[model samples]
Target: MFCLPVAGIGASAYRGWPTRTGDIEICPIQLPGRENRFRAPAHTSMDAFVKDAADALQPYLDKPFGFFGHCFGARLSYGLSVELAARGGPLPQRIFASSCLAPHRGGYFGGGRSGPFTPETTDEEYMEELRHGCELRGEPTPPDELLGLSIQVLRADIALTCGYRPPGPGGTPLNVTTISWTGDTHMRPEEMDEWSAYGDVHQVLLTGDDFTHRSAPADLLQVIADGLPERTGVLTP
Candidate 1:
């Protein structure tokens, strides 16, 4: 399976994941402009980004593979699944999404016309937004230099998410099972239920914040293990 990180982050965001999840090789997708790919320009468009990701993943598609993404990465993973199917590439056996609303749900940051944060948004305001969302934990906030860099990456990420326009009605639903792993403390049951429209839904609600992927990696991995289909060839240790 390939792991995708949330916004303003890269593959390192999934550093806590075990080397392998069951029989699945835990390959984390490192988006550009962060971590090792820091020099690469951040993708500005989701469609173009997903296409590039799909092309880059072609060689790895030899075996049964799947995707796991959180927050901003969730939609990207979904788009990749759709794009692969459309491009006659290997389709995923399953899609694991966390802490994100379904595309049709459509209300972003209170469903505003313009997103809560934009490229022009002041650095101070962006930091405040992060704090208001309770996303900044740990003592000793990042220094201004690092924080400034993070804010730039974050703005680019926000642009991708905010610019995303969900597909219209009557779209083709994926055949693969979709596991919606949401933190019960953060997402409503009803809101998560909307994922069923995408495919066979196996909802896993756990105790944590929106940061379940980070704070409770083990519990989240267990959920994935339990939901792995027999055909997925997940080796139990």
Candidate 2:
């Protein structure tokens, strides 16, 4: 499976996840502009980033792989899955979108600015955003240079998500199994139900907040294992 990271983070965002789970091999997506890719420019839009992701993940799709993402990353994974299908390539057998609502619903991180973050966002406003991010991450606000970098990448990601446009009325639903996992404290049941518009949806309401994917990976793993196809006696990996 492939795991995508939330805003202001890279592949290391999933550092807490177990290396191996049953037949599942957790391969995390390392987006540009963070961690080892710090020198690279961050993607400013979800559409563009997903296209790049699809191209980059082509080789690994040979097996019955899956996509998993948390919060902002969930949106990215969903977009990538769509991109892969559109490009006539392999599609994920199941999609696990955690701690987020469907694409059509805008996120809490973005405050009206659906475009790139510029000198436009005042210092105070940006700080507020950072504080909000800290809350979601369940961490103290970063300081100095680290804060600056986090704001940059996070704003870009928020812009992408806030500006996302769902298919118009009557648009066809995605032909894949989608699992929406939202924390009981983080999102309301009504919000999680919105995912049904995406496809055949299964909802799992767990006990925790937005950071549950990191805080309780073992529980998440069990949920994933249950959803995975049963080859019965054999473990593929």
Of the candidates shown, which would achieve the greatest TM-score relative to the real structure? 1
lDDT of 2: 0.69
lDDT of 1 by residue, 17-74 (tens): 7778667667788888887888899987788788899888887777777778776777
Per-candidate clashes, comma-separated: 0, 0
Whole-model lDDT values for every prediction: 0.70, 0.69
Q: In model 1, which regions exceed 4 Å deviation?
A: 107-110, 113-121, 130-136, 168-170, 175-186, 230-237
Error of 1 at 177 (Å): 6.4
Off by over 4 Å in 2: 107-122, 128-141, 168-186, 230-237
lDDT of 1 at 48: 78
Give the clash count for model 1: 0
Per-model RMSD to reference = 3.7, 4.2
Candidate 2: tens digits of C-alpha lDDT, residues 16-45: 887668877777889998979989989887
lDDT of 1: 0.70
